[model samples]
Target: MKKRRGLSFSQRRAMSGFLFCLPFILGFLLMFLVPMLQSIQYAFSSMQLGLDGIMLRFVGLKNFRTALFADPEYVRTIAESVRDMVLQVPVILVFSLFVSLLLNQKFRGRALARAIFFLPVIVVSGIILEILSTDYLSASIMSGQETIGAFRGVGSYEILVAMGMPQKLIDIMIPVVYDIFNLVWSSGVQILMFLAGLQTVPDSMYECARLEGATAWEAFWKITFPLISPMLLMNVVYSVADYFTTSMNPVIRMINQQTSNMKFEYAAGLSWMYLAVVLVLLGAVYWFMNKRIVYVGE
Candidate 1:
């Protein structure tokens, strides 16, 4: 009898990945599919409450048109959401990677350091984030009700002037500077992801590089970075998603307002548009990063 062929190593790996993702695929189909389709239908229709149930009248983009042309705040909030995502994702990724690198190094209290960095992931939750995002809290801080918030006063502005930055640029950077705490707070998960990736990099590769007279920078650039590129891509996608959907996002707040006011179709339209923007951004990120990402064994 002829010997039967077995799957290739690559084929086995592919099958394993598929099996790992099978639960998520099944969950999405079973739990999310119907609600997602109904929400999409809501984006293009008017809702009516009848004795039977909620009836949807297909309106052919009227809801979308109203959201775009009629609501002034919608456009501004959307623009702000995108702008915040653009600004914060890079900062978050860089900070996460930097902290992860430090955490990956052998040092006293390494475990404690890792735990400290990841504490934000445990401590921050939806309710806490909502409170943090409150306008009243921001106003209180900015108006000097809090000592830390009083940093908004004069020092950074003076430093920027002394350094000769443009006033417009200073205005943008000042808010971002004050938001540093939030940025750092948001990086816990990405840091954990990066740490995982960093740990997977073999010590032998660094030893070999050292024996070859490679500087620490050279070793990092030549070995550590290339090996971690896949995780870098993953963290970037996560950061983008988190920034665009966070409780602090004005766009999401606006959508929630619409929903609360019984404007279900309008809210659906807003959410769908927001989702479209996020999907496009994630697609662009994947396209740009995929070519740069180095997979193991590749």
Candidate 2:
């Protein structure tokens, strides 16, 4: 092989990889960066639909002031959205891990099972979720017309509900009662990431643990959990974002309505503010979880 001047084989390979990604890099800057800057500009302005219905004028920082201090529903809506994020993140993480463990099991039909778990990541979109939203699986329970709900009655809680479980126990489960639904609908990516992480764990590590008289549960707690912690962190962030931006999400609907009503500047400000809050929360999660993660290669 002829040695290239200045650039080694690996360096040349890196350059080729950068060249391959050039189109995506350019598109991201053009499509996302320019629009994002424009949005930030608009967020500070006081643009509104005029009486002629096709004009706009600037009234700087008024939109932000209205959203922060004057608007009736803006604060409440944002608070509710953030509350949902906090609740949903942990619920999604635990349930996704549970489902992933099942999918990772060595079973005859495991591939099919994994596909079923991943259906949501593939098929979930605005249209499909809109169709499902009309069904309102939680409506009965929410309205107190039924003792329990549809999917909750059937899936993970089936055994307890059928066995005449205590009402208190059921009540306690209410906070995360529909978590299985969230899990089933969100497990696609997390399961795949977990499977990837599981592959990275060498079987020899388990063998060594076994030789040291470590039980299966001990091996999982000491070896498997730490090894996969980074993937766990990634899935947590993805699930939180996915929940907030989902088509079926109420906050997104509210934002859509604001846009349709031509409240462009206000909507833009709200979106930017909301995005900042989410970024801060995600940054906090990363900071707190980063140290706990064990880098197996190191």
Candidate 3:
């Protein structure tokens, strides 16, 4: 009987995907969209709390002007945040990738090693992490001479001093060196993502490369790197977002300070600007990396 035709496989698959995403779409619209719109409105308006609630008055570009010209520290803090992001993201990526490769190798206590690497992600999260920073738990526990952050950097700084390197070079290296522990802590998620990607590599490909007399390095470049390129892009995006949003980020701290001092409109404007900057960076990264990512079938 000439009744009805069902949807094609592709159409059905697309429908399924849409259904899977529907909840998130609805949530974004229903829950998050209003606040986001309000934030944009707040950015351009002067807001004051009254007996009722937030009272917003149209202020046009005043908040933006305040942030850009009136406040010197705002731009400086943002610049520092961006500078730290540029310095940190690559180091974190390389460190996580290298450690993932090591942990993927056949060895005793490999699981333990992976767990050790990942422990920070579980432990150093949320307000707990904030409380455990230098001003809090660290200050309470560490002696004057044995401060954790200083202790970690002191050895490296001394070694470099002994080496008679240029002061400018030493100044550069010292920050990166001092942040070694922080980098490690921040790397836990990236390391885990890399391990997931590494596990997806088929053993047969490596075996074939070995049979073809390819060295480990050649195998890595030819096989592993191409395959893991996708995950590398993911890690880059993640690291960028994490760096910009972390508790230690000066930009965020500045915004929080504004909010705390009841500078709601100004805070909103600063936040919107920061969000735009981050979004632009993320868009550029995704575009560049998406072009380079290798799919197995391709």
- Per-residue lDDT tens digits for candidate 3, residues 35-73, read 989889999999888999989999899999988899999
- Indicate whether candidate 1 or candidate 3 has the larger TM-score: 3
Task: Summarize candidate 1's per-residue lDDT along 1-298 as a digit string, tens digits.
Answer: 9999999999999999999999999999999999899889899899988999999899988988887899788888888778877887898899899999999889999999999888878767676645754655444432224333434353545776789999788777756655665777789999999999998999999999999999999999999999999999999999999878775577877888888999888889999988998999999999999999999986
- What's model 3's overall lDDT? 0.85
lDDT of each: 0.83, 0.76, 0.85
Rank order (by TM-score, best first)? 3, 2, 1
How far residue 215's Cα lies from its native spot in candidate 3, in Å, is: 0.8
How close to the true structure is residue 188 of candidate 3, measured as C-alpha lDDT?
A: 97
Residue 201 of candidate 2: its Cα lDDT?
Answer: 87
List the candidate 3 regions with Cα displacement exceeding 4 Å: 1-31, 51-53, 126-177
lDDT of 2: 0.76
Distance (Å) between predicted and true CA of 264, model 2? 0.6
Residue pair clashes in candidate 3 = none
Q: Over 4 Å off in model 1, which ranges?
A: 1-26, 50-53, 125-178
Report clashes for each candidate as comma-separated counts. Answer: 0, 1, 0
